[model samples]
Target chain A: MTNTENAPSGAEIRLEEVTKRYSGTASPAVASVTMTIPPGKTVIFVGPSGCGKTTTMKMINRLIEPTSGRISIDDRDVLDIDPDKLRRTIGYAIQQAGLFPHMTVAQNIGMVPSLLRWNKKKLAERVEEMLDLVGLDSAVFHDRYPRQLSGGQQQRVGVARALAADPPVLLMDEPFGAVDPITRGNLQDELMRLQSELHKTIVFVTHDFDEAVKLGDRIAVLGEQSKILQYDTPEAILQNPADDTVAGFVGAGASLKQLTLLRVRDVELKQEAITARPDETVEAVRRQLEERNRPFALVLDERDRPARWVHKRQLAQASSLRTAGKPIGDFVSTQSTLQDALEACLAEGGAAVVTKERGRYAGTIDIDTVMATVQRLRDEAGVSE
Target chain B: MNQFFEFVGQRWGSLLFDLYQHGSLVLQCTVLAVVIGVGIGIAVYSSPGGSAIATALTSAILTIPSFALFGLFIPVLGLGVQPAVITLTLYALLPIVRNTIVGLANIDPAVTGAARGIGMHRLGVLTRIELRLAWPSILAGTRVSVQMLMGIAAIAAFAKGPGLGGSIFSGLAAIGSKTAVDRALAGTIGIVVLALVVDGLLVLLGRFTTSPGVRARA
Candidate 1:
């Protein structure tokens, strides 16, 4: 029943002069690649197939023996230790889940712990905890076999199993590649949520740059022969790619992708929004709107939350703010990203989107404000786009 | 048909004894074959050449005439159940060994890689994951071996091995006699019945021993 809250933080992973060349092959699969992965961060290796990204990852856990070069975790050489023993200290998840069809969900998750000879009771508790951690109910899923679960569920169990022992490092290779697009997006979000709590050092490999940009704390965009073209934060990489090679991988929606990284709360809110109580007389609201030279004023309920928007022309015909102008349906939350804010504005067909904090009216963000903020930040960083 | 019933009624005691002995001989030989075959399969399953050689050798043994194989064993093991059981065990090896190898080899490499990546030693992965996943195919091999050897065990009566095969050869030796067809009919019927019963038991065994996950697939 030891709390993971007190567990040791993730350890640093370092690869120095790492290279792998299969026998009988003229060129090395991965050539002289070296990178330092900061502790408790997720670094993704993204490139096209045959770029040796997977081979490079396999060398970290020694699944594939390195031809030459040094790989060290937390400053200890991986080759210096017994591979099996070293593997027990690291978590590894792969595509297709690779769950043992002969084992129950609980048994699969408890495998490493059981190998370490954990007592049955302790193992059971850990299995339940892992199932919960992955958002699966232990009561319903513990005894079910892999075939009994859906593909997405099976992958969740795979992740739970990898994290069962709470290993400091987790290596995942296309973990969501087999699922449908919607399910893949959900799993990606789930992994992000889990990483916020566990903070394990993760090396995720995928051919999809969008996924890398979404999940990676830092992304290593690799080119042919596993050569790393650029390694930097997702925003930095998008705003300032190392060269045309990296930019090609980043693809056409570079600015739009960058907008996804910025949250609605990241920009300054326009506090100049005119507002009136629901019971306020139309003449008073019209006077206030006129004073501000604004066309519309938000009608607020008793709790200071938006009821509706009242237009200056409607105020002339209406007695109170209660039944004036048009009702706004799309309200963006403070936690929503700038993309969400822009989408909300477009969906509502309004010039600006209202922001809500804890169900109360916070402020508003116009589409122009979002674009201006993004452009200003890009210029400040001296990025061309 | 009446003559067959008459022969059975008169030799009812010995006939039951013959059936029991037939069951024992087939069981013993099949069990021995399973152990040796599965052992060899596991030992060489990892190597392509070794697996090919082992499967080919066992399969070659099956192509040999049963009568000749029994006779060949006579000079070394002599008559009675020894030569008979040995011959049956040899006949049983091909299916068991082939299936065991195929079963182990067919397991998804991703599954084994995951097992190894999760820190299972080679032996642990083989025993706990690979073998368990391969169990259904291995059991199928065992079933084929058991049924095949049951008939082969009847042929073992050429060396005077235990079982109803003795009755069959004896009836054939008396050729054209009234009781000849009766005895042969009884022996043939006995062999078929025994095969059916053994097969039914194996189906039950597969159900009971196979994991629910593997069974769900079938």
Candidate 2:
């Protein structure tokens, strides 16, 4: 909702007047393009073939030298640095995994680490850990050659290989493109999960719009010759396109697309002080309760964070003193994404209470907030009842 | 029976000695030709836009008539194995150069892109990824060149180059005798055997260098 320029400063990667012109070509493949990618975020470049999205991403890691302009990583000019040494610190993944045909999966994933000369024991452990991180069984894959794996499996190996050395920056160019649609989706989700945990600054190139929306913390929509038409969060790009090019690129239902981008935090949550604590028994809770008719009471830990909810029906099953002092951090955090919050609700097998770290209660979001946000987004998009 | 046994006893030692000497010369021709041709072939192949030059040079050298090229070289190098070896090496470059380019170009772009993206410099990418991926095709080219050179090297013996060609020239010098025809036939068989053996060896080298997974797919 706020201008990105005015947003808090972060570790940024910037490209200024970047251009790539192949020999014998009339024009530069990538024109004067300038953009920034914040640290610990996923930025995807999406466009049709020949649009220069791939070229732009390649320039970040010096895979393709630009004809002009400067590219910087973490505020340092990339040209001043040695390309190979610079690339060693950046994670890169491509379609089909490109695991070394001669190397086994383990060796492929261990490439960067091995190059960095990490001790053998650490390298072995990291390789196995990466394999497991990408959901591959190290035992099954560590010794297996790249050819033995299927397209999807090869891509999983690719991701693990890219992240092997845990570089601060990652460059991925359609890393899942070779796989079938179903597998691609799974890999996308896996990437999202990985990004959440690893928080590496990532530049992803793809031709798929849905993928950009699903994975990108920000999406840079480019036109012919790799000109950026708009670079913004999915919601902003969808709901408030910068120009006709961006509007057309966002396609139909751009309005409702904004709603999908909003999380539960965007909607109001029910907040009240009338809640019980982990140490409070049902009888004592009832005695101290502000309203006896309350159908559900929030449970809190010592830090006053919302924990699990206790329904009146469950009160009869609980002993007076036994239920007291049970820490409720197992309950999900309030700041979780809507989908995660919904999952937590389902996991609780009843109403889910939102809590913060240190057991502070942040209030609960019910089906109402979820449905309202969904309906509001639908209405804004002009969807019929 | 007495004449045949006497003939065998009389020529057997010389025949074995000639076979060993000529056999080594043929092997020498094949190896030298491949080395020279492949050396020039890689240069031409690696040239940004010099394929036409390689083609022209090879085709023109091939057109001079194998004997004529040797004849032209004799005045300078003097009648020996030098001219013959040089001609065979020239002839071998076309196939080797053409195939090397094809192999390098046909390497999956994705693999090369991945190599670069993974932090490999130009040399690293070339040696580790491109060369390895293109190994089979390059070796295929080498095989074609070696087989062709083996046959050509035998013909080189006409210009005083060693090989079974010596026997053929000797046989032709005594054309009126039926024995001459028999000797020529034996020489021809030897040349064919040399070609087959070299070809087999090149194919084996290609197989050894080729990645097992790529071979299985092929």
Q: Output the number of the TM-score-best candidate.
A: 1
- For candidate 2, give the lDDT of residue B27: 56
Residue B198 lDDT (model 1): 93
Model 2 TM-score is 0.75
User: Clashing pairs in model 2?
Assistant: A278-A325, A279-A325, A304-A360, A304-A361, A305-A359, A305-A360, A305-A361, A306-A361
TM-score of chain A of each: 0.90, 0.69
Candidate 1 structure quality by residue, lDDT tens digits, A1-385: 1235655568899998899999999999999988999998999999999899999999999999889899999899999999999998899999999999999999999998988888999998999999999999878999999989998999999999899988999999999999999999889999999998888899999999989988999999988778999999998999888999899999998988887788888888888788789877888888888887998888888988777987788888997677788888888888777888888878866455555765688888888887897788689679544
- DockQ of candidate 2 against the true complex: 0.42
Query: Candidate 1, DockQ to 2 decimals?
Result: 0.80
How high is each candidate's TM-score? 0.91, 0.75
Local distance difference test, per candidate? 0.89, 0.74
Write model 2 residue lDDT over B1-218, tens digit each, in one string. Answer: 45534544666676556556665665565566556654555565556567667667767876777778777888899887778767777776666666666667666777777777777778878777766776676667667766666566667777788667777788889999856776676677766776687678767876777776567532
Total clashes, candidate 1? Answer: 0
What is residue A64's positional error in candidate 2, in angstroms? 3.0
What is residue B188's positional error in candidate 2, in angstroms? 2.8
